[model samples]
Target: MRRKVRNYILIVISMVTGTVSFAQTEIENPFGLVYRDAITENLPGKVNIQPVTYTLNGIEIAANVYTPANYDPDKKFPAIVVAHPNGGVKEQVAGLYAQLLAEQGYISITADAAYQGASGGTPRNVDIPHNRIEDIHGMADFIIQYEGVDSERIGLLGICGGGGYSLKAAQSDKRFRAVATLSMFNSGVVRRNGFRNSQVNTIQERLKKASDARAQEAAGGEVIYAADNAIPTEEAELAKIPYDLYREGYIYYGNTHKHPNSTFRYTMSSLLYLMTFDASTNMNLINQPLLMMAGSKADTYYMTDEAYRKVTNAKDKELFLIESATHIQTYYVPEYVSQAMEKLNVFFGKYINSEA
Candidate 1:
C-alpha cells in the first residue's frame, strides 16, 4: 500500500512537470506527426506541410510550415508562429492548430523548442523560462522570413506552457502583430508555487535540489532530472491523479495523442530559472492586439486569467473562455478545438490581415 501511494505521487509529479524529453520513438505518420488527420504527403492545391530546419542561436531548430490551399508564393499571406505546449512537440496540438489555421487561409508554422523534440540542444530538456521564450522568438524569426509570408502581418499562437512563453515573446517582439494563447500555463509559477500552490511549502526544498543539480552539472556529474517516470497506463492508476489538467493529460499525451518526442522530464537545474520567472510580469509591454483563450472548467484557468488581467497596455485585449471545456480538452476535442479556431479566425483576421 505504501509503494502504491508512492507510485501515485510520482505519477502526479510526472503529469504536472509540463516540460518533457526522451529518446525518439517511431511515429506512425509519414510526416512523423501524431496528431489526427496529419498531412501524409504534400500535394498541390491543398494544405501542404513543409519540413524545415533553421539555426537559432547556433542550435538547429526543426519546424513545420503549413500553407493554405492553392497557395501562391507570389502573393503575400498573413502567417502565425505557433509555440507548442510544455512537453509537447510541433506535431501535436501545435500542428493541429497550424493545419486548422492553414485551412482558414493563413500560413502557419510550429517548431520544436530547442533542446526538446527534434531540435538541437545539450542537457536535453533544459526548460528554463528564458530559453522557452527565446524559442517562441526564434519561431517568429523563421516564419517571418518564409516565402509568401507578410513580415508586417505575423501573428502568434501558443498553447499551454508555450502560451506563457508566447506572452513573454510578444511583450517585445513587435513582429507578432497579434498574440493569442490557448490553455495558457505559467510554468514558472507552477514550478515555484506548485500547481494551484499545492507545493508551496516545499519551495525551499525544491530550490535546494535545483541548486544541487546545477552544482553537479558544473562539476561534470551525471545530470539530475525531475519527473522522469513513465505515465501510468492502467485506468485505476490514472484515476488516482486529482487535477483534470494532469488526469486528462496522461490520456492525451500517453494514450490517444502519444508522440515519439513527448515525455515529462527536464533537467532538475532548470528549476533555478523556472522558479523565478513569471509570465504575468511586465505584461504591459505587449502593446499589440491580444487574445487569450482558456477553458472555463480548466484548473489552469487561473494562470490565464491572471496573465490576461496584467496586460494593461495591450490593444484590444480579450479573455475568451470556452465553456464546459477543460484545459486538455481544448487541445484535441473537436468541439473545443472548433470553438477555439473560430475565435482565432476572427481575431487573427481582424488584426493581421489588412484585407479583413
Candidate 2:
C-alpha cells in the first residue's frame, strides 16, 4: 500500500514540473474547483460572498466573507470564522461551510493562512503551527469588527488542520463564543510521528534534517521545501485501498477540485517548530462550548478522539461522527457535508445565542 502511495507521489512531482500545460486546460481562473456553494460570479439569495483582505502581523491576509441573506449592516448578526484544512484554501471546504452557515443566518468568513494560499508571507508554505493559530486569532480580530457582526455572538469552526489550530487558538482567545471542528487533524502529532506513528523511529532524523534546512536558509542558500508538487491522471486508476484519505485527497486537491494555490507541502525547516507543538496541551483552556465532528471510518479519527478526551474544560462538548465518511470525504461529499453543517447550525445557534 505504501509503495502504491509512493508511486503516485512521484507522479505528483512530475506533474508539478509541467503545471503550466495542465493548468491551461480544465483548470481555469480559480482553477477547476466544483464543490457546491463555491463562489462563481455572483450568488443570488440571502447568502453572498465578498472578497476581503486584512493585515495580520504586517502581512496581507486574503479572505472571503459570506453574508446572510438580505444582510443589513444597521442590524446585528452572529458571526463564525471558518478555517480551512492543511492543504486547502478558503475557497474549498472552508468556503463551503462558511456559505452554508451564512445561509443559516450567520455571517461567515474563511481566510487563507498568512504563509499559504493567497495570503502574504515570505518563504511560502511554511506551515508553522503557531502562525496557523495566530491566523485564527487574526480572523477573530478582523471579523469581530465586521459590519453587522455582533461581537458577543461570534463563533468559530475549523476544518482539518485548521481544526487543530482552532483548538489551540480558543485556548487563550476567549472571544469565540462557541468552537467547533470537523475532521479535526492534529498537525503537530502527524508531523512529528507521521500518520499513526508509521515513522516514529525517524523523529530525530527528521528533526535534524529540519535544523539543517534552517541553517541552509540562514547561509543564504536556495530555499529548500517539501511538497507533492505534481498530479498525474494515470495514478488515479491504480488499485488502491478503500477509504484512504490521502489517495482521495490527492485526487480532490490535484485533479477534480484543483486550486492553483493549494499544495500539500511545506518548508522543510518548518518541522523544527511543527514537531514541538501540541494542539491539545492546553485544551482545558477552551472553556467555551465545543463540538468536534469526524468520520467514524477516518484513519485520522484517533487524533480527534485523543484531543477530545483532553478537552476537559469545555463547558459543553460533543464528538459527533458521520458513520461512514472518510477524512477527505467530509470535505466534499454532499450528504456528509449536509450532516456536518446541520449539526453546526444547531451547535452555533444554541451557543452563539446564549450570552454571558
Give all TM-scores, in the order shown.
0.92, 0.89
Number of the top lDDT candidate: 1
Model 2 TM-score is: 0.89
Candidate 2, which ten residues in sequence have the lowest lDDT sum?
A: 1-10
Question: Which parts of model 1 are misplaced by more than 4 Å?
Answer: 1-27
The sequence of per-residue lDDT tens digits that candidate 1 reaches over residues 1-356 is 01111111112223355333323333356677776667877778889999999999999999999999968989999999999999999989999999999998899999999999999999898898888889988888888888899899999999999999999999889989999999999999999999999999999999999999999999999999988848876766766788988888987788667777887999999999999999989998999999999998999999998998888998899999998899998988788999999999999989987755
Report the Cα lDDT for candidate 1.
0.88
Q: Against the unseen true structure, what C-alpha lDDT does each candidate score? A: 0.88, 0.82
The model with the greatest TM-score is 1
